[model samples]
Target: MTTCRLCGSSNLASVVDLGATPPCERFLTSEQLDEEEPSFPLHLRVCTSCWLAQIPPLITPEETFTEYAYFSSYSRSWVDHAKSFVDAAVDRLALGRDSFVVEVASNDGYLLKHVVQQGIRCLGIEPSRNVGEAARAEGVPTSTTFLSESSGSEVRDGHGPADLVVANNVYAHIPDIVGFTKGLRALVADDGWVSIEVQHLLTLINNVQYDTIYHEHFQYYTVESARNALDSGGLSLVDVELLDTHGGSIRLWARPREVTGEQSARMVDVLEKEKAAGLHELSGYADFSANVTRVRLDLLRFLVAMEEAGKSVVGYGAPGKGNTLLNHCGIRTDLLPYTVDRNPYKHGRFTPGTRIPVLPPERIAADRPDYVLVLPWNLKAEIMTQLSYVAEWGGKLVFPIPRLEIVEVNS
Candidate 1:
């Protein structure tokens, strides 16, 4: 972390230090709980030279994604979002049955399945074998490997240039920003489009979404920084769209540098918004660290008060972000005994440093806890609807980030 990953600059300023925590997704089995766990410095810094906010690459992608625990299809809303993106991309790119589409980090074929249904040629480059197998089971032609400059070229050679390359929610996972970007360039055709969806730094700061900061996400991006990163790999940013996913995100439309045209109006508007927010400079990040502290304090206070009031509290989701929040706030099983998730992969495992048991979603109804702390608050609407039956026992839902609020559920 001595030099910026994007730009080789010694000048890096602290954005926030989440303290030392294990890789967010490293859920432990009962046997591993007795063993000592390893943690790393989870500090985030911003490069003054290029304005890219990043964390040290303490853990490699191989360590995290090889046996991934997260499956995108588990979240109904996310699957729907992926389907919408596929429909929109096909129409926008004028794709047809003859067109070829490729998606990077295509977990469980949640997206490419839509492309397959339309009789288009599609492939998924997923690193995780288990999830990749799941994708194959669903009829997605998947290549199990990490995406890099060389790998990207190989894919292009084997499958021919993709008409469209889709990377969703994975732009930040790679430590080698330049190489991954080049890999993206290699997978796409000279005239084909590359669409990437990543969490927007502007919204992250504005909304106090600090939990999204974890080891897997090597860097965070503003549209300005993203444009620079894209140019490094010979890809040109053509347009941008604001998305409400992952707290807040931006969908970047890019193309090979040779065929790139005038930047779209939406791209210009977003850059203007970034400049107005002072994101192009260091001022925009000045208040973020302090805001993060306030969130920690507020959440801790609520959990402690709930304990004192004899109200039983449990977690709703055991997502990676939830682990970050749980560890940063020093929450343990004493406060949150267990959390539930829809994914069966995590049913019997425990959350990485917190050691809270992960149970099935039905456990919530069986126990009828007084309060359910909803993690993965980005899916607030979907989760609220799923847990509407909580009202049967006058149970309430609690959200930790941005602020602590308790909402009574009504069936």
Candidate 2:
């Protein structure tokens, strides 16, 4: 993009060009395999002025989220994480049965179900019709629409202002950062808390998690940039918490500017940490592109050596991040014959660009593949426990990001 999506600055610098890949979630049906798949440039650029890392908004949110393939409830750890967050939020915010909660991009009611059980009134604003229906079926009051300023205002008007607004792993998904933030501000009460959990740019760069970069995530954020983004919507950053989810993420606690209190010590400490990492300057990103190349090379070498050794390597999850890693490393079915996912929607489909077949999780044990490459490595603990049965067949698990490592699972 010529200008930064958040700051409107014309100055932008390259972080890494992952070459071109299809929309990560655009899985293909057998009937459409003969048709040409569409691809777009997957380049990440940082706006020096605002220090916000972003990709060109080649695909709209509607195209990706309208009939989304990702169902959040598939991951047991994530569900447990959501439940923990709900419990903590209720306690921290002194929420009760009379309190109202709103969650943006609430997928399949994974989180709001906990809110429901607490006897609190809650609404989920999810864009995907399929997942939205699933949420409704589970008794979550959901409105299927993208969060814009208008929609957020309408929700607030219809249901009254939320006592707590929770947006998890979705702050970076929208191209219009300012408008989305405004929508978040619109949905929350003037004195209510807004809690957002997003992948921290500090962790993304330091850990070389380039695989998370896709057309769907238009921007990345450090606490500095996130604070600025929140300010644009009249929300002031109050507290911050470093989380282990999605490799590394930051949970930002914010409030309306008028009611915002002094910055929490935790927020101040995180900002200092970002400064120590040089995230506020261009130097922190200097080694990122080279590090990304190293990771791609390392993973490719492992896969190729496995192939030459006559060892079968299949993927564990067909997540969006996995598609980026596969497409970037130029891996086809020859290297990874197929991958399995718990999501039924992807069982018969092929991963975008890579075109590797997706099967059910049972196939891993049934086929007894020599190695199961764990694609969604962020949930390593949970996945390893579930696939510990692989040890029965002398199968090992492979993790690609943060570094390439193969582990022997104990039964």
**Number of backbone collisions per candidate, in order?**
0, 0
lDDT digits (tens) for residues 1-411 of candidate 2: 799888899999988999999999999999989999999999998889988999999999999999999999999999999999999999999999889999999989999999999999999999999999999999999999999899999999999999999999999999888999999999999889999999999999999999999989999999999999999998999999999999999999999999989998999999999999988888888899999999999999999998999999999999999999999999999899999999999989999998899999999878999999999999999999999999998999999888999999999
Angstrom error of the Cα, residue 171, model 2: value is: 0.7
lDDT per residue as tens, model 1, 314-405: 99999999999999999999999999999999999999999999999999999999999999999999999999999999999999878888
**TM-score per candidate, in order?**
0.99, 0.99
Which residue runs does candidate 1 get wrong by more than 4 Å?
A: none
lDDT of 2: 0.94
How well does candidate 1 match the true structure in TM-score terms?
0.99
Clashing pairs in 2: none
